[model samples]
Target: MAEKTALISLNMGGPDRPESVAPFLRNLFSDRELIRLPGGAWLQRPFARLMARLRAPKARRAYEAIGGASPLRIWTECQTRAIGRLLGEEWRTAVIMRYWEPRAKEVLTHLRREGVKRAMVLSLYPHFTAATSGSSINDFCRHAVRFCPELDYRLIHDWFDWPPFLDALAHLVREALARFDGEQRHRVTLLFSAHALPEKLILEGDPYLDQVRTTMRGVLERLPEYRSRSRLAFQSRSGPVRWIGPSVTEALDTLVDEGVREVLVVPVSFVSDHVETLHEIDQGYRDYALRRGMTRFERVAAFNDDPGFIRAMASLVASRVPASWRDSRQNENGAPCQGTP
Candidate 1:
């Protein structure tokens, strides 16, 4: 049993509300942990400000397509509540979206005010990448030390290789495969799509690509039946820089060109259906696939509130927390940590 309790912090991604787009994106771009800039700080702010102004209108339109705002926060709240329920009243959990409401700084401030003695920084992202989890962890580290200097911190870098997470992903994929029609089942090709990172980052020794590959490997090892048909793809890349390729849309087109009529897209990167999954995959890519003359283009549902997923998350929290909180700290007596470390 632990002598002290630990609070878990989360980065739930960003929002898409019309009114909030500029501020939200500005926050995103301002994070030095993301969008690394070479110019002076003064120039960077103006550059970011300008980009936010230019991008907000177009961003607002996309958000408007799927109801006037992003549903990511709602999903985050659901996850927070579910985790809270599973952890019970002993361990308090608060979510902080890096570029949206309940921002990271605010959550840290709240935890500080609550007098938390220890904390666990958990990015909703299971895979580690400088662009995603690294950015959030860097921000938390920078601020939390000054904000709560006395607190002990345990950061969960990644859960990409955990067994429960792998199991949950496998279970979800299996369930989706079972639902496919007889003609679609054996003929279906699996497309594992993830958010893209610049080629520069991969060359710079960022483990994002490797970690994702491990995630793919774990999924494949658990699915002996699907191994022969699945392929990996990348998506949602921005800017002019070269990104990890065999882009999802390009892959979809190629599959169609090759006479493969049915394809199942698994958004293995994201835990929730955010703008990328909800709009990009469902609307943009689905439209592209339909236009390319593909007969079926079904997306595996995001992990959202799946019981297996929730249980996996609970298990992660349980394993990470001290025994004093849950009264079962012994290694053999308590559940072992099972997600991507």
Candidate 2:
């Protein structure tokens, strides 16, 4: 019998419904890997619960703005199916959301039932961070050891500057640019926005900022037309603690100072549509840009289920699959394996 193989995509999950918002926040805050409680590890849960209660109303409103729930799980399901098709019949693909229902425990249980012997875990986050990829991978490993110790696992930590991934982004940028007329195209500033993390993470030597910068460089290298007109900014910063510099808001202000009237926002950090993309970027930043006298402000859609992105993800997975278990099918029947050479 062919060896049973499983591919797992790790992500930071959001609430699927309005009611789940508070609980989701609670789960997110409770994770020590994300934010440490002021008191002690023992107080983490209580503090998280309290903070969740306080933040839920605002979070719910954000979710309400974007069709009552996050579109992340929906997009992730489509992505998994696309990748599964690419992987052919011998392999199975599963999504593990760190703070949501389809979590590591459930994923491991399902994989065990499927008789999976080898697993290739892929972090959906192109850039690695202790809060996101680190937390998810650590949670999965701890559970896998306790629940499915026999399972063999391989992890692709980060594919930040992967060629195919950059290709997909460049394609999206070109598509976004096409929306403007020729006269306006030259004036459109390509703002590459990534989620903001606390400055302390960079000070502590987290590779996320460096990887994000590299990813930006890679994507810009693929689009010479936008290199001089492009800028990188951080977004979705919360709380009182100082975060990264040149935030999306501040970046927009600078554009206003430079008399840039048109902007095309590209969310480089996120692959799927979520509150960050929908509410934050679309509603929040668009409004900010317009009120600041920008005539045109549009956001490039997330690479959710895009064929090139799916192909890139498939290639990433296939590269990690043992040669003995690699499926021989190709062309019309299977996805082409294309990645960074």
Off by over 4 Å in 2: 324-341
- Which candidate number has the best TM-score? 2
96-137: candidate 2 lDDT, tens digit per residue: 999997888888988898899877888888898887778888
RMSD of 2: 4.9
Q: Tell me the tens digit of each residue's lDDT in model 1 across 285-322.
A: 99999899998888888988887888888788667764
- The residue ranges of model 1 lying beyond 4 angstroms of the native Cα positions read 1-6, 322-341
Clash totals for all candidate models: 10, 0
